[model samples]
Target: MQLSENLSPPEGETIDPTSRLLAASERLMAEAARRFPIAGDPHSRAYWMEAMINQAPDYFFFKDRDSRFLLANRAVISDLYKETDLTGRTDFDLFPPELAQQFFEIEQEIMRSGEPMLDMEEKIPDGRGGLKCLLTSKLPMRNEQGEIVGIIGVARDITERKRQEQLHLGQAELLKMIAVGAPLKDVFTALIHLIEGQIADVTGSVLLLDPEENCLRHVAAPNLDPNCFTRIDGIPIGPAVGSCGTAMWRGEPVFVADIETDPLWEGYRDLAVPYGFRSCWSAPIHSYQGQVLGSLGLYGRTPGLPSTTCQKLLGMATHIAGIAIERKQAEDRIQFVAHHDVLTGLPNRSMLDERISSAIEAADDANGTIAVAFIDLDNFKLVNDSLGHHAGDELLKTVSRRMLDKLRPEDSLVRLGGDEFVVLLTGPRRRGEQLSVRLESIRKAIADPVLLEGHSVQVTCSMGVALYPGHGRNATELLANADLAMYRSKEIGRDALQFFTAEMASSAHEKLRYQEELRRAIAREEFVLHYQPQMDLKTGHIFAVEALIRWNHPERGLLMPGDFISFAEDTGLIGQIGDWTLRAACRQNKAWRDAGLPPVVVSVNVSARQFQEPEWVERVASALRKSGLEARYLELELTESVIMADVQQAVALMHRLEALGVHLAIDDFGTGYSSLSALKRFPVDRLKIDRSFVQDLPDDPDDAAIARAIISLAHTLQLKVIAEGVETREQLEFLRGAGCDEIQGYYLSKPVRAEGIETLLRIPNI
Candidate 1:
């Protein structure tokens, strides 16, 4: 087939009959041009030529070397000259001076080179105040003597084709910006310009829905007047609130053909008419889940509905705008979740450090002091332990809001995790009274009673203040010193604030010295484990032994766990100590087996910090494998508070440990506030009654009731119950009567050395 026979329309469009007619006319004209000056009367031949040229759809014309029109077809005469004859007219009379000069230069080039210029695209005025793209072909015309005289040109309008290409390209570029995580504002700006470029006499805008305010906020409107946008911005969406707002409210396209007459614009007509916005078309931008996110709007100077092409462009603009808005919102949500507390919506530790460092730098430049205050809710644990975590979370949120309301705008309040907050303030040095007054207001606000989960709750806080340059330099030191002062506040009274002094610094230095020594203790093998036996209440035989850590301080001599366990936890050194104790206990148990002693499951206490490690489960497996001890002979005891911190995570970790054949037990069970539903999910073998409950048991009615309740609950769940701190004979008798499976305390035997345990195991009965 010939090229013309194989011609197809643009993708997704039908073939235009006008295009086919132009093609056929061009072929006929080409042949007719070769056979010009036929054997006939000159006047008759000229009349036939003029008639055929006039019948052609495309613009056909002849121009002299100086770019003067010699003869023009009807299309050119009507379109360019308003049906006037062009026998002596020049291009300068038909086009703007610059455009005419351009045409003349191109024609002169074709005439000078004796070549043809075909299929060249040009942008020219369409006689109105708009542009039209055209594909033109020009050839150097020759007289009968074979000398060039003028040029003949044929031009076809390609405006629609170019517009479609530009729209597709613009869509691709906008998608690229979204894909590469460009800022939302830049993408919106480019999007508005892209739409305005394709459509004439219109301004574009993008408004994102603010769900909190229930209003449309302008995001991008590069071509719209700023003052006009400011007036219309933040308008609440309604059925008749103009194009963009109504489109968002209805979650569909809204077209107001005339701002003055459309009922949708009745209330907003003044806002539009004064700004020359006579018409508007808006489409709601929807998320992938089909929820409306915002709207993309176009405003025109004339009052009429948009053309078919303009409508298509608007649809594409909304789709692209939707993608960009959704992506940006998702990114913002992720960033917010990472830096803010879920319970109170306060900034978390990560943001706290950044803000503190910035505040410190500002203080240094101004030769001022930065106050770092550490705030700890005094009775938060008591409230949480009694009211459950849900109520606890509610109380925390209320307290956070109250404190925030009482603080200055320049001050920053941050949650450092679990009932602890840090406030950073900067001012001139030696403003202790001023700082104290401010902190007192915050303290009073937090102490106010609040209603949580329908229960009247009240709480107080302890605050510690430390200043820059005097307390210490940098965030770490300042925070540490402030923590020490907060501890002092708690020691002296429940609700109060304490400023860091040289005395506190001296105490911190001592603690720091001990921390350094503890680090060496781990490396030099200066730590030892002691085992306390748990005796079966029915048979009076040793069933298991609990492992306890004691720091063998070089300078201070041997120290019990009470003297150093909390210190280790506070310094974050408990993880390392816990790992060492695990391996050592496992090794000792296997050695006892090798020594022909009875096998007793060794119960090792897992600290909260150690239990929360990402690799904690793997660490347990490693300890068992490396020590040559069977997993069945090892029991990992975790406190109820540790397990209850994150119940789902604790449950999952417990299951994984159980899968490895290790026994699990909840230590100090009755002390932590875990819901029955959460507790039943634990795959534990036993629950240990806390020492506090067991210490005053049998005589103290409340303690006795708690102990009996725990034993019954454990038995109902098909698990064993163990009582620790049973020092009195009466307590042991009462526990045995209450159906306790095991008992461990000084009453059985105090925690003894490894050799001491061998002797006790041999005796079999405690």
Candidate 2:
């Protein structure tokens, strides 16, 4: 019998003595071959075997059947037990009882079954009061006798691999949770739960930093005393504070393995002792750029350090903390942007509407009055035109500041775009006069001068004040009434204040009705023309007729110029009326010619408001062409105000009309703001003396002298002169002696209908 078979060396030894001796010789050759594997023959089998054994990182060894180590490769001898010598050693000598027992069991199973035990894990004592993970594989060795004799084992250190596997699992879980779009609080809670489940001997809390309050608040905590947590809810971050605070202050991880001895717990020993937490570890929750947002910490009731697994779990929790904080901040920023104006940083129009509506409801319930004043600046256009828009923007900003300063704590001053503002004054009005006085005060407050870019700019606003329930019962009506009153204040010369009244509301209604009536009247052809005869001053013979407008109302019989002329002028309807008058006068003159009547020149008056139109000349030319009237026989009568409104445009229009062969006569010549020098610039065929001068003519010396002077001026300018409203023969003879070109009045013939014009023309000479 061989000595190896009878010796029965402890478990894990399976090789016989002869085979063991062969393995020793083979290991020596393997070392020599490993040093010079590529020498002599690069493809030799010994070189290939040496290359495969040395390149492998696992510990490889062969043992005898008596359980003694016979031959061990350098990896097995130097790495497996941190020993350089492994010859004649048994597996029991290299590992502790538990590790040795597991190794032998695996070895015996592999030997008996003649199969390899692949990748079995066992923790071996590291000889430094810790354990290391090792993966071992055992394969049965066969002798030349075809019997299983011993086992050759290969073992690998896999401590880091297990750590990496756990890390990968945590990352996958974290990624899945983040993908589900959980709330930040839920995500933080989930991170804590994941840590508790994955790591052993550790419990922790999550504390978020509140930058605004400059403190840490406990967001989540597990396995901690409720009273202790409440006491640490708002701990400030500083040096030598608790683990979380110290980590945040230092912007790095802090490990206090023994909280009782660490200086960081010097001031908070009671906080640590009562909680039964002897050790603490903290990692800062930081952005990728290293901005510390908060901290994640673990607490251990015993005075022990955190294992590697617990440390890795803390790192993952820190990452999750950063994600949660960023998401919460983004939500806050979005909420702020929703309610505030981007330009002014004030509440926007929607906010203002809600506030106003709420204030109105409160006033109604309390039986109080709320005054809403709408203020609009006067001459703001002049400022914008002269100083440019940049200056205008600065002016608006300055005005807004001033308006805000004038308001009380309870009052709300809102800007309704450029140069317009509204102030809501809540409470009961003392009286109507008191409200008026307060409004005047507000107007004056906004009227102050502002210094802009070294220039003193003055601005004044017209205010319209409307009372709650008195002027309007709702928000919309109150605003409308206030706006109407503001416009009325502007009408009565701006920079004034007015209150809403029943009369103003009635006036607004009347305006609406008038606009509707005017539109319908134009469409229905309800307007007509009357002719007033103009006679020769010296012969008393009617030679021409002046055309005047008359509106025949469906129910009111007849309406004169004073009825709707102002409204027409204000609404730009005068241009249409002027066009109709020109066409009708031209048509009547042409009809007289076609009817074999006298060739009387038909003159129609033009308004100052109508002369400003660019298409005036074209419209007149088209009317003349359409009526088949001779352009020379058609006369346009213009007032002094009409010629003086815009002299350049008027001169150009007169020149254009003269080129078309139409006659131009200045009507009401001396009654307007016109100079003799300005008069000479007009191209005219005749000058008509106004009825105001002729009404007192031949009796009042001033009136007669004025008419005579005008007639003489017309003669000197080579323009025909006509005297209007010549009611008496003495007035007529005086005009005749002055050599007036024409005279027209009741003394000649009143303004009559078209059918009556022939009777007046057929009458005997006066």
Candidate 3:
């Protein structure tokens, strides 16, 4: 029978035939008839209807002809957790504006047609994520006179059932990862993500118990702050520890309703508050034998016990975590050997790559930088040769321990192979000076003595540093650059740290190519010498000339010493090049004398490498003998650094040159650390004051004083003091007044080719 046909009708008014009482218990139907007053007597009907629906769990409401809420139940008024009465209010007050308009139109249709609406599925916010399904039924309600007055509606919640279906489907997909033997970390990551998706306002994490360290280490926490994860990791399990730690320590599930005020959560309240986590529940993960392996925790933004759905899914995650944890523990020993160094117990290259990639991503997201340091022990091969392999192994272990002690707990040290390691400094790396300070500490730690086989062996390491996003965007480029820099440190001298730069990376290859080209230049004669005449004071005459080498590149024009000399010195090519220069300059001087030109001594500069050779004196004698130029017509000049380095050696070399009747002079004299006592013993005849002291001339008092001191010292020693780089009359007059024996600078003439020197030799002197 229809809803109005079974109910009584009033005498003066007919029932609204389209209106009907909805299906309910027999008692409810009778109560509705009395409350609706089918008999047209309605003193207590309104009160009964409001009181009844208020106790109903489902949403119930009645609206007037204008779509205003004439009455509402506890469920309707309590939406979004608001407790105010909704009487005489419109749907605009209870729902969003657009939703209210649509609801009004639907209710108006039912009221005008006087028809009952069966079950209609609608979705709305369950006051959480705004996505809950409900079954709504709308119908017209008549008054005691049987006249249609307004519309009444009832809604039943189906959110929990729908969420349950999604949860089960998601869990099924997550199980496949574990079935295929995915990595423990990957599986845990998937499991936590699935639980978070089904549960509203909650994030999940998985932690594994490291029995050796007696702490809980984070396995997966996709939503947690990375820095927070790092801080929370390695938390020890004990009484009143964090939720996860305490749960594992007690061997049971633990729930913290409010992190801010809960005594059990007091330890981590500060850490959780900043991340917007106010509630937490953790379940202990257990193996099949009932031994606790780890914990599965769920954290929510608001403080309270978790929902039924969150609690249920947390238990499911705990089971999955247990399976993976047990499997990983069983395979830990084999896996550790595969990923870590066998001798030093440090992470191997494969694990280093994994960790570096993760660190790089985190750093990029944080807008920070990380330094990858490649370290190699110096003379490590020597240890293996002199002491047995066992002794070398012991030394490696000792060095590894020392280096590890010098790093932060978050930093990773990986042994890439024998005598080589990489350190991932997972801290702020914006400043190079800060990294340099840290690297210095590590270097000093590695330099400490290591006792091996009853012998104390002092070891040192060379390290190269590369930064992320500056040196490289990824691990491979970073590692390659760092390795190149380390080799550069070894090239210059070992036992120091070098930060990687783009220039350092190309220097080695460029220098090698340059050395080869220099060798070819020696064979093919691409080098040409320019002569700068040294004037004799008190006489308009050119007494000597300094031969400067220049390179004529086939593509680029003339190249100066600043372009390739340092590379030549570093590669030991300067020795051969300097020898060639000496012989060439001697022959040119002899050619001038033979050509009926005034005889003049030509000085050739000596490099540190050429000066250290045992046959240096013999090489000089051969150059003069081959050219048939008398020794007095040739001068050999050494920079102050080369001469002052070994004072005794300098005196002997100078004495030998003097005994051969060849002139000797110190080039760039004032720039070096030369002692006055030592200078007196040297058999030098001339001191070429450095251009740095003469460029400013009399204007710069410091330079003037230095020039004066050198001139005075040279005169006291009975040696000639030649001031170079003089470019003005004031400078020339100043030097002449100070008793400078000679002047060689632009004030006379710029350095020129031998042809130009012909004119300069005939020109007026300063």
Candidate 4:
């Protein structure tokens, strides 16, 4: 029964050590089973025990009460004892002093209690200069009389399982950081560190793609050399660029097993190889939309292809990095949009107050003067109304650029909505003429002619200056005073600058008196509309009439809109007055049609404030309904500035009004700014060329060219173009020859009363 020598493979056959050991274990178990009936057979028992101990794959051992090793498996011998015998030698002879002491204490406890310890986890040297985790079990070994004689132990390596668990926990922690919106740099550094921990002898890095520069820049390099990292920070991405740069360029994995031999690393080899890096593997980080956002790199000191598991870890890391980077970039874009103007990409009102406040603080520390200049482009509306919104936008951009060129590097310039901007200049006190000279240069720069929409256009700005600590304190006061000064410049003559003074404040008070009068005048029904007949260019007959509002003042007599309209707008009374004008114009048109006069569309000018009202479209509908005028007889004219301010909103509103059968026309078409793409989306029926373009028509080449362009653009869009302020036959003839559809000016008839319009309508060929 104890006839086995040693288990071995069959003759003329070959097998791996693991397979050979497994076969030997099976044979030994079978022999032990057959010999188990021989009671007290010492030879058989010794042979069976020795065979099993030497052939088993796991570490199996036995020790006496003193914890000396009586037996050990081949696995234990190979890992710990090597060529030396393990029998009768305690764990102290095989392991370090601390490990041996721990084993002896555990064995003594098992022996004393006659019990077993199961699945106890412990770390031990793997004999390869690394640690290995084991799940060990120890039990008391008893004799025939049930008296404990020794302790038996068995252990299985669980290093891989432990590694997986730690990797999962680390990944979860990183995802949590990303979910909570941790800074990108912090997340990237932590991610790189995690990757490096999971892979051996490798440094991890993250390189973000800078699209503007077409380069890969190091965002995170947890263990790479600082000097080398800096040198490769902005490496240009190309097909043959180093691992990270090439990976991003190709949008795929790139593996360079040897830095010195791989052609992809030709130029970058010096940056890495000299620093102990011999190999690099990179995986591209891509956005959900498949755009290459960045790349994750694992750089190794040894040259070899990554194992399958290592490559899997790299893939997962890149995915997580992409999510973090994309989220951060989206947040940055939102922040930028919130603070910048969508039109010109300039800091808007949201940032203006903060910038000015900061400038004020800096000035206070230096006992300096700060000039807040309010700039209004004079006749900018005319440009918009003449050239169309597209031209207007180009002119504004040109003006903005010219103005920026004249400002100091420390100065702040902000666009405060249509045709208005605020400039902040800071310097020592009594830099008086210095600030003025800058403003003059800005003025001259603006006055320089620039081509827009094929026409050479020149624009001038009116500037109002208010000094901090002099024109009152704070952003609001300074801006208000500067605005008052700007208006003074407009009043004296446009293209000029004026400093805020006590007299300007007095004028503002007088305007308040006029505001109240204008408010009451609305309630008293003292406002009237004058009809300016628009003549059809082909038929030479009045087709549509523009309704111009007139205020009948109790003391000042009849006043033009320019006299008080701006003040009304400032006081927020324009909405009520505009509503009255709309209703009156609708009623007069309906009354004329009922009186058997020729039916014509009555166009009413809508102020920017009125057009911006949430219920403006409904208001227009109500006017037509209450006045009993067919919607076709009414047209609402909105300025280009108003319509272009919020194109999406304006488009939706215009469509709704058009559904009600009311036509829309862009009033002062050339003066405001709009892109051609956006213009085509508008639901408009006409383009009214601003009078400023027609005032010098047929003579001023720029004006004539602008007028022709507007006419052509309108007709191409299947819309009508009307020339306003045509005071002479020569202007009318030019407009007619240029394919203009209609003309409205003194040449036809100055804006007249409803009776005058009726009389004109009754005349033949009016």
Candidate 5:
């Protein structure tokens, strides 16, 4: 049969056309081949087939029923044997012994099961010296009778895909650990292991930066000698330093692929060579604000560049380090503010209170004693008033510093408030004198002058020392007793120190009781007013009566002013008692007026407390109105102390009271602290010479001269003069000869009730 005739086209009308001729020729060949078979030489047929298969680009091969290669294309032959004969050779015979064995086992499995194996990984020899990883597929071949005869396989290289798959798996494991929120150390360790396991010949470390120490500390490392990493724990960051140090110093990533040759590691080469690390890559751990916090690094025994994945892992570690550093710093700041004072930078009141409480508990536990010394600076107000508050504040701050320096380190100094401080000393009473000496030293230290604004200002402090289990056993009692002692020190002339005593407590209790009794005495009408007639010395006529306070006690018949007046003044009870005296004296004088007795003026002494009351004027006016007495006949006697308390307020109050038609007299005029300036400023109608001046008037020349001078001064000021405590006739004669306006004393008559005064008034003149 003719090949061209058998390939002839089907019947066509136009046989002359080239297309029709070619088609007819093909159809004739096809008919001939179908009707008859042609015999050919084996070598020619094989040569033609081999040429056709070898011309293909893909690897092609045929295997016998026994799973041995019968024929392989040129591409396969070249891939498997480097252009050498691979036909009629099994995979085991063509490749390295082990790899070839694996391929044959796979082929045998495919043939025995009559199943095709697709995309199987196989290693083929490159014929140079190494092997190539490839993807091969084996398919079952069948004869015309549909029986499996051999296997046909095709292969394509997939070494790159397999490498990518392994890399992906390692990255997935790392990401899974990160996503689980593992501890920082564990995460870092896992990362190191991942790099050393998947990547080639690598060692790595993490270093945390210590800002206070100005150094980097190794925190984690894998595949490195412990001693090598430990020695690098506290390395200072600088230029031309090792890889981690340099990265931290520049706040950037540093790569040294050849550690032995890199200048950055010149001084640190010994550390690398012994541990077999030839390359290192370091990335600085930095905060969001761009502050370098730490570094993450990779070390390799061989010279190599870091993969992009490794750099990305380092960046993640840097972020975690930054967060940790910020959190730790924030916690430190919170703790500092909690325990420190903002203004003075000293331990604040909270710290003081805690220390005191602990000391108290300790003292109680050990049966030991603790002393709390309460100190108040004397004359602090004068400094504030004269020099200004700024100077006063400076003085206080200086004093605080000095006091702290004077105390023992174990002792505590606390500022209670303005001009007040407390010092706490805790220990056993092993040396009483030693403690006293220490305290005296402290007092002297504080008493030293402080220079402020180029002025040497001397400040002295009064201390009140209270001991635990002696003055008080608790904090409140100790503070109270200390405060009480401090007041006592002030009363006894400040710039002194006093220990809490039982006598002070007793006296305080008595004063408190007296105050309560005085309040009740005013309300219960137990208080009475006595009248002592004030006679006109020249006319010998009773012109007025001075009212005196007398306590008509239920137990003790009649109590003089000497018994309770001082106590009343001290407890601030004098105001209430004085108000009662004013009303009673006015009412009694009105009673006498109604009874046809002389309409003489009634002088009632006003206490300092009463005079200082804001409503003193109103009180006086109300008293006169209620008694129906004319204000002109009422005389209000003010002591020198009353006007001196607040001179301006006193002058204003006196003027207001005087404006109500009441006469104001300065009682005890020459015996008080009133300045001559204040005397002229006061609005008074008369000056009453104090009894001290008149008691020795006739005997003592000084007393007589003082009385005369007072009378002369009163006349010069256009004010009348009255001499009180005129007990002797000679004293009375002296005062009269001195031209004193009025006289009132025991000689005329002691202070008696209103009815008794009428009897004395009715007596005829001698």
Candidate 6:
């Protein structure tokens, strides 16, 4: 009530009115001034105090000694929406025990000492969300007897200022780390820790964008539920992807609160729900020139947008991250170019040399040997000149892949520029022959034909080997010796391999002369065919003849196949010679039939190299058509050793021959290893037992047993078996009793010229 209205004299005093009013107002105003001192009327102290408390920016509350609230200002009532009552409510009633205990202790101290606790920096709740940086002060509320009754604590909101300062400090430290060339992951780790410390109820992460995979890879994400990170490690970047991927895809920041309902978290809501994170925000890390490198993601358990401080921190971190990632990628590119071959991705000469040096030291320490092979592609220039350089490049790439596939994981094949490469074999010692076998496998792999530009281009490499301590004491010496050996291979003929030896250099001239003579022999057409007759044991009649090749050197008189066949194979001339032999044999057999000789099957030997040709079957068909001879009259004999190497291809080829009605025979059967199961797949008409089994057969039980088993096995398969080198009547009788179908050796006739075979064929049972 207004004092002026309440102070009227009862029933209107009859005395002087002005004097009476002056005395009454002076007395009431003096008592009001004692309680409230303001610029306005002194009697309205309660209104002034109430206005001040409600208008104050900071929270003002008074609590009793037991921390029970006695009075709260307007800010306290509005901020702590549910804590309105002042009669019975205490700090424990509003806050958790741990938080209320802190308040209780401060209030107790203030009341006991009758002093004020001022400007205490504390992390307290702002009554709305998360923790706040608060500068709280508590003062004792005392009565007139000097007994403390209650306490008042005022807390000013300083959350933004405190967090902003912390963010700035963290940014400086992180930048310093990046400037000092910290590893990308390490810098990311530091940034994660900085964010987790400054931002309340949040986790930090740095996800790198993989350009190749077009996804975000989790680089670092500490202080988070592992599922939120580990489960989404490589998320594809797209519109519907999670925060990190979406941010990178859009090249901007993405903020998602209430993840369950956000469209951006359509498929990923379950991932955050289980981990207790309800919100996610991501900002793309861009290169200085604006390329999206990766992203920085922040996740929080509370559903809300990022605070102002967090937003500022993410911006700076992404900028710094871009610079670091770019620097790292550039360094990696330089390192890769220096160490690897651009064409094959194999080690280059520099890396190979380094490895060789390290290998040498290790080998010397263990007193072991290391084989270093230098490989050079033969006739590579011809391929480049005839089929464009592009085709040549394709051929090289195919060969590189093949040779690489054949190497052991520990072995390294290094490109030494152009058509040359070096291979290093280290670790446990291997025999010289084993190393030779490995190198041979690589050469054979390279020899497979590669189809490029409609032409099947086949390549063969010449590999020269030099062993550590035996051929050279160092890498340079070893390489030089290997080069010398490679040159020796070229001097002998291309597509040949040799080991380093001092004597090879002196023999090189002699090898060159021999190569020249051999080349001339092929050009001069000085080769002849000899035929050996095989008589049927059941009828004692000659029905087949094996054609043998012999070289008639102009000055050397006559030369056996042993004298020139190896050289021919080494020079890659065996394919041509094999084709020639087939044509000659066909024509000769046809002529013999035209001459009224007894018809017989003409068998020709096919070498390993010739049989592997892509057109081998076509060549056979062409020969039959050209000579006008039936395929049934001709039999192609292949050694067991060659056919067994690649059983599948051999089976297919033999089946093709069967389709052509050409009889196929397995020659030297007892001398090779053939699995019974695989041998059954071959569509062969006969198995010619190698002569070695028959030469001393009847007397030697091992040979007799071998020959008997072969004949019995052939009969079981419904195949005819022939025993060669049956020079004696005893051997012939033994083979016949063993169920052999035929015999071919001196007992019948030696390998003679076609005319000589025709004479024997017309002699009936002779």
Please name the candidate that would achieve the greatest TM-score relative to the true structure.
4
lDDT tens digits, residue span 1-766, model 4: 3323454557898788777666666666666667663434434546667665667767888888898888778888787446357778877866799997998888899999888999999888776767788999999999999999998889988888988998899899887776555788889999888888778899988889999999978788867888977998877899999999899989999998999899999878898888899999999999988999999999899999999999999989999998888666644443454456545777777678788899899989988779899999989999999999779988888888888888778888898778999988876534346677877887889899999888999888899999988996898789989999999999998999999999888866777787788878989989878889999989988888989999888898999999988878878999999999999999888998888888899998889899889898888888889999999988989887788789888898889989999889988765555543356788899888888778877987766766766675566567989888999999999998999999998998999998888889988795
Q: Give per-residue CA lDDT, model 2, range 1-766, as digits (tens).
A: 2434444556887878787776555555556666765555444555656556756887778876665677677676555567777778776887777767776777777777888888888777655555668897778889999798988878888877876786678666665454433566667776776776566557778887778776788877766777887888788889988898899889899999899998999998888777678999999999766788889888888887778868877887798678657644533333333333323444544345566788888897887788889889999987889887667777777777776776677778776656777778876554554666666777777678877667789989888988888998777778878998899989999988888898888876788888788777777878999999988766667778899888887878789878987778867788788788889889888988898877778888888766777888888889999999989888889987778778898999999989999889999776555554456678998888888778867876756766766776566567899989889989888888878888889987789988888777667575
Q: Counting only residues 3 or more apart in sequence or on different chains, how many pairs clash (N, Cα, C under 3 Å) in candidate 1?
A: 0
Best-matching candidate per lDDT = 1
Task: Report, for every candidate in turn, its global Cα lDDT versus the true structure.
Answer: 0.85, 0.77, 0.80, 0.84, 0.77, 0.82
Ranking by TM-score: 4, 1, 6, 2, 5, 3
RMSD of each: 18.4, 31.3, 30.7, 17.9, 33.7, 32.6
Better of 3 and 6 by lDDT: 6
Q: For candidate 1, report its TM-score.
A: 0.57
Q: Could you estimate the TM-score for every candidate?
A: 0.57, 0.40, 0.37, 0.58, 0.38, 0.46
Model 3 agreement with the true structure over 142-239: per-residue lDDT tens digits? 99998899988888888787777877776776655544446888888888878877876888888888889989888889888888889888888887
Badly placed stretches (over 4 Å) of model 3 are 1-506, 764-766
RMSD value for candidate 5: 33.7
Model 1 accuracy (lDDT, Cα) = 0.85
> Which segments of candidate 2 are over 4 A away from where they belong?
1-186, 201-203, 222-230, 233-235, 287-290, 304-308, 373-466, 471-475, 479-766
| Cα lDDT tens digits for candidate 6, 191-218 | 8887788766788889988899998788
Give me the displacement of residue 489 in model 1, in angstroms.
4.7
Clash count, one per candidate: 0, 7, 2, 15, 17, 0
Candidates 3 and 4 compared by lDDT, better number: 4
Better of 1 and 2 by lDDT: 1
Model 3 poorest ten-residue lDDT run: 17-26
* Model 5 ranges off by over 4 Å: 1-213, 216-235, 269-278, 294-305, 357-367, 373-423, 427-433, 440-465, 471-766
For model 2 the TM-score comes to 0.40
Query: Model 1, range 1-766, lDDT digits (tens) per residue?
Result: 2546535566798767887766655655555556664443434446567767888988899988887888888888777547478888887877889999999899999999999999999998776667778899999999999899999999988888998898889888887777656788899999999999988899999998999998989888888888888988789999889999999999999988999899999878887899888999999999888999999999999999999988988888888888887766644543454467656888887577678888888888988878889999988998889989778988888989998997777788999878999988765534346777888999899989998867888899999999887887888889999999999999998699999987777786788988998889989989999999999988888978999988888789999998888889989999999999999999999999999999899999999998899899999999999999999999999887788789889988999999999999998876455554355689999999888778867876756766776776577567899999989899999999999999999998999999999999899566
